[model samples]
Structures are given as C-alpha cells and as structure tokens.
Target: MIKAADLPQTLAVFPLPGALLLPRSRLPLHIFEPRYLQMIEDALKSGTRLIGMIQPNPMRGKKDALHHIGCAGKITQFSETEDGRFLITLSGASRFRIVEEITGFSPYRKCNVIWDGFDRDLGPEEVDKGFNRHSLMLLLERYFSARGLSTDWDTLKDADDELLINSLSMLLDFKPEDKQALLEAPSLTTRRETLVTLIEFALRGGNSEEMMQ
Candidate 1:
C-alpha cells in the first residue's frame, strides 16, 4: 500500500455491493443492519469517522472480487435517533486502493489501503468545451424533462469539475461495467469522455431502455 506522509492511522470501511461515492458529495447512509451499526459505533469512538466505500464485482468470492478504485468518505455528521438507528452523512474524501482485506477483525471489515492521489492536482488543463459539454447539457436537459424531474439548473451548471463528474456518474443509468470504468478512470478527462459518450448515446433515444443492460 502506498502511504502518504500525512496518512491517518485507521479508517472506517463499509463493504457494500453496487454503491459508489465521490469527493465533494454527500452520501447519506442509513445504518440499521447489525454489522454496520457496529461500524458506526467503532468509527465514532475512534474519532476519525471516515468510511472507505467499495463495491464487490460479480464474483461471489470476497477475496477474489472488487474493483481497484473507490472513494473514501468522512463521517461529517451523524445522529443516533431514539430508536437506535443511525442517520449519517458522509463527506467525500480522497480515493483509495484496497491492497488487501486485513484479517483478525470482528464485526466490521478492515483493509490495508493506499491513497491513489485523487486529491492531488494534475495541473491546470483545458476542459473539453466544444461539442462534448454543450451536447451533454442539452441531452441532460431533455433527459430530465422526459423524466419529469425538477432540478436547479443554475446550481448544476455552476458545479465544479469534480462535483459535475461525480454527481453525473452517480445519478446516470450506466451499466455496472461502465460505472466501474468511470471509477477506474485515471483522470477527470477520461471520465468526462466516458460520460459524454454515454449521454450522447442516451440522447439518441433508441437504446435508452437498455440503460442497465
């Protein structure tokens, strides 16, 4: 595992299937299951309250599955209701690669992780503006209109690069492999290209029914 100079000692991790998180976004999670309830308690007690969210691949073997990339989320805000359930809000942190799952842990799973430098600046580069962003915005408008969903366009338009990419990645009806590809994308540019292509395909309106297929 690649360790950063300022790496924290421990992290809270949640192993789930089909969930992805990204930086600068809020992941609101409901913690009611026994194992996850314990995870929350351990995180709060440890004072870090950070959760590494990763998903398993199609393979059933825990040791043999899971993509290499995932986002780390900090437990920014949480509340335990009278019913003993946890309502927690997660603020996205840096991305991490799970070197391997650590053994000898009870209740919650633990893994040795290496930071993938997602927070580091790749230097200022020109964003794709020609046909990509423009076409995406138009199709996005139509897609939302067709679904009868209301959104604050002003807010979405003003979102920063990371927010825009991650938000769209999370909400879009992309296939699992496509979603994993976005997660594994080395740079925002690559991720954006994948998204633009997907949106363009969606805009064509022929294969829209196969969103998950």
Candidate 2:
C-alpha cells in the first residue's frame, strides 16, 4: 500500500511551458499525455482532486526545470470520454511550491508541495471608475486589430476582475518570463503594474521576453 506520505501531498501537477494559473480563476485542461492521464485517475480516487499548474523556465537548459511558484486547483468539474480521455475544469484554490517530486512513480508525476502562505486575504481595491479599464479596452482593440482578430467588447466590459485578468492572461501570447512574473507577484497591484508594463512594450514593438528582464 502506498502511504499518503509515499505519494506527494498533492495528487497531480500539470506543467505548461508558458501558462500561469492564479487564484479566483479557472483553468481548463484537456488531458492527453499518458502520465498526466494517469494523474487524473489518481486524483479522482483521492480526497482532493487538486492539481498544481505551473510553467517551466524555457530559458534554462533542458535539464533545468520549472519555476518555484504555481497555483493549486480543485477539480470541480470533469468528464471522461469514451476513448478514456479527460476534459476537466479546475477552479483555482491556492498557491503552492514543490517540495520535491516522488522518485520513481510510474506512469504519473507527483510532488509534495507547500502553500505559498496565502491567507486568502483580498488585496487593496482600486476604484476603477473605468479609466484604466477603458484604456485596456482601447489598447486591446488596437492590439487585436494588427493581428486581425476580434472579440465581443460589450461582454468584456462587464467581466469582473478575476474574469478580466484570467481571460487576458490566457489569450495573450506573453513571454514565458513575464507569465512567471505575474504568477509570483504578491498582490493585484503588482500584477496590474506588470501587465501595464507589458502592454507598453507591446505598443513599442519590443519583444515581450526582453521587457520581462
């Protein structure tokens, strides 16, 4: 019998090269890899189907690995396909750090983790009487224009902070380092500043990765 300690306190960890999952958001995952598929199975059997979603530092060598910060998500909704694949929805839970990966887990990767010490405390609210909000909307309109893409602005304007941030983070093809910075920032103000900086760089046609540094 595999003791609870024998396995990582966390059931599964999914790593993406440039994605960040933050609290109060949702991450949709389509599980296909054999290891990760098994991970989903194990998580279903466990009490908390919480998975840590993180990104690898691509600038590091192949042998080098992921950054230290990530978010834990509870598997709130899931559907298994007839072909044995999983389409799952993860609602953000809290942040965590990998203590270490279990040495020889076959068919799945598991790791011990410590929460990033988030007290679930909300951050200082900025009264967005809609200036920065409008600025963002305008910039996004122009940003998408050059790429010839379109979105429903009326819908976007009504989205709450969590929706606004998560949607933008997922859709934007930001550099890996910038994504990591957003993940590790302690508060919303910091995250917002980092994003503004990125937008300014994009307006100047500067490389996103360079702006991160």
Per-residue alpha-carbon lDDT of candidate 2 for residues 107-183, written as tens digits (9 for 90 to 100) = 75567786645544123222323337877788788788866888888889998765686667656778877887777
Report the CA-based lDDT of candidate 2 relative to the real structure. Answer: 0.70
Clashing pairs in 1: none
Q: Among all windows of ten consecutive residues in candidate 1, which has the lowest summed lDDT?
A: 121-130
Using TM-score as the measure, the top candidate is 2
lDDT (Cα atoms) of all candidates against the true structure? 0.69, 0.70
What stretches of model 2 exceed 4 Å from their correct place? 1-8, 62-64, 121-131
Question: What local lDDT score does residue 179 receive in model 2, on the 0 to 100 scale?
Answer: 82
- For candidate 2, the per-residue lDDT at 90 reads 82
- Give the alpha carbon lDDT tens digit for every residue of 85-138 in model 1: 999987766677878767675777777787756644212332444335555678
Residue 198 accuracy (lDDT) in model 1: 71
lDDT of 2 at 193: 66
